[model samples]
Target: MSPRTGVRLVTIFSAVVLAFFLFGDWLARRDAPEPLAWYETYRESLWQPIQDRSLTLLQADQALGRGHLWMISADGEPALVSRYNLESDDRLWQAQAVIGLGAEEMESLVEAQAWEPGIRDQPVSPAVGEALGDRQILRMSMIPVEPLELNRIEGTFGSPDVRMPVSEGEAWVYPRAGAVVAVGEEEAFSIMFGLRDES
Candidate 1:
């Protein structure tokens, strides 16, 4: 092969590699979920119950098998009692107890827990009847709540529990205006707890 031909081939290969890298980077950034203010509010609200119950957010990986954003322990015994996730700038969460703890305590607990080690695991659906609250709560036995892509609304359910005939392995649950949400069949939809005004 001639030196000129070799140099031209090398240049073409470099251009292709550069283009691939640029395209991958742009797609990753575009697919990233949007930041949500409600996530902060909802996180604080969910942690309130744990603090109120005197449970501590463990520094260990408490939620290994159980799929949830945060995990807490009462008396050093870790239990997956709460669930939280962020989708499309919206927050979804579900807890065993109501979230009405004092703001100061919740804030402090959240701050302390922030420094704790994170638990990485696949998202899991909450168990049936585990999400007890004042309002209506249902379990999605058909669909399993899996993470969804940014701005993608496929296989998602909306707020207000409406009993309608759904195909097997397909269900949707939307978070109410003042309710707690637990991941159900899809990341976009989750099992919602009853609403309680903080004020």
Candidate 2:
């Protein structure tokens, strides 16, 4: 190629490269992650004064102290509350002061135990879904119970069925998992996520 043509080609390439990087930096700076950015939005928007009052007044599961339920977290990292606050409907979330269950809840859990059933090819109905969860497989230490008989386990309902002794422990609420089925001698909570207090 001629010297003139090569110089023209090189000049065009350099201009294009320069334009690309310049735009890229502008985009990144505009979208930078800012911690207080979210907080500032909440104050300026619908949540306004309420959010401001909350930041100063509300802390830790209701009472003010070290165990505050809502805070920036230990390592300056975002925590559950911090993340939740970013949502537009954050005001709707009822601020819960309750952490672990009370004495009564503990007492109910005392007689009852969680069972870990083996994973099956499909999820049996909590009643018949034998391969459900730990709450279902292990009979409560206090009560004598038998696991349901079944095989295949299924979808996202990964948590197994749980059983509590007939009429005991504030009714086994498998809050996080799946729906609960009323079996012969057991109260079934679906999966193990919703009301799953167990890890």
Candidate 3:
């Protein structure tokens, strides 16, 4: 074949190959199942009751089988925090809860256990449990089983009510939902609920 004809033939072959691959990719994407939404997954999980302040520190411990506990001040108020791990489908998921403690509760905790008030994760003493178990959970945060991309969140929920720069990520807060999504450079890593109300 002539050089010109050979060049044209090569270009046509390349174009056909590119078109074939593109079409295949499109078809594959079209046939793929839609991924579960982050909110839906969260709501269906055992952590749902925590969002409505229905779960107490001790109840959560019983349900999640006891996690690491910490005594810390949240917004200038004494609070009890716990972290739990859930193993499912060979993957590990983590959740955290912050329970607001009253001054009386803090006094009780201090008197009952050897713990000094500070931000540290320590073993939960039976005395501490008895003191704060019934305290209402103020916030719940979780690391999802699957990574959630930042764009997907914005696309689904629109602009957040509050967007602020946080350590290692940006916090996207939705006041009406009382939720905050911590988005890193690529994807969202953590989500928290019960931060605020619609009003």
Candidate of highest TM-score: 3
TM-score of model 2 (CA atoms): 0.21
| C-alpha positional error of residue 178 in candidate 1 after TM-score superposition, expressed in Å | 17
Which residue window of length 10 is worst by lDDT in model 1?
135-144
How far residue 58's Cα lies from its native spot in candidate 3, in Å, is 4.7
Q: Which one wins on lDDT? A: 3
| Model 1, global lDDT | 0.37
Residue lDDT tens for model 1, 89-183: 33333333223334564455445444233443222234321332222112111111344432433213223353333543334333333333333
lDDT score at residue 66, model 1, on the 0-100 scale: 29
Which lDDT value does model 1 have at 41? 49
How high is the lDDT of residue 77 in model 3? 44
**True-vs-predicted CA distance for residue 93, candidate 1, Å:** 12
lDDT of 3 by residue, 146-182 (tens): 7666655666556788889987778999876667888
Ranking by lDDT: 3, 1, 2
Q: Model 3, residue 114: displacement in angstroms?
A: 5.0
Quantify all predictions' global Cα lDDT against the true fold. Answer: 0.37, 0.29, 0.70
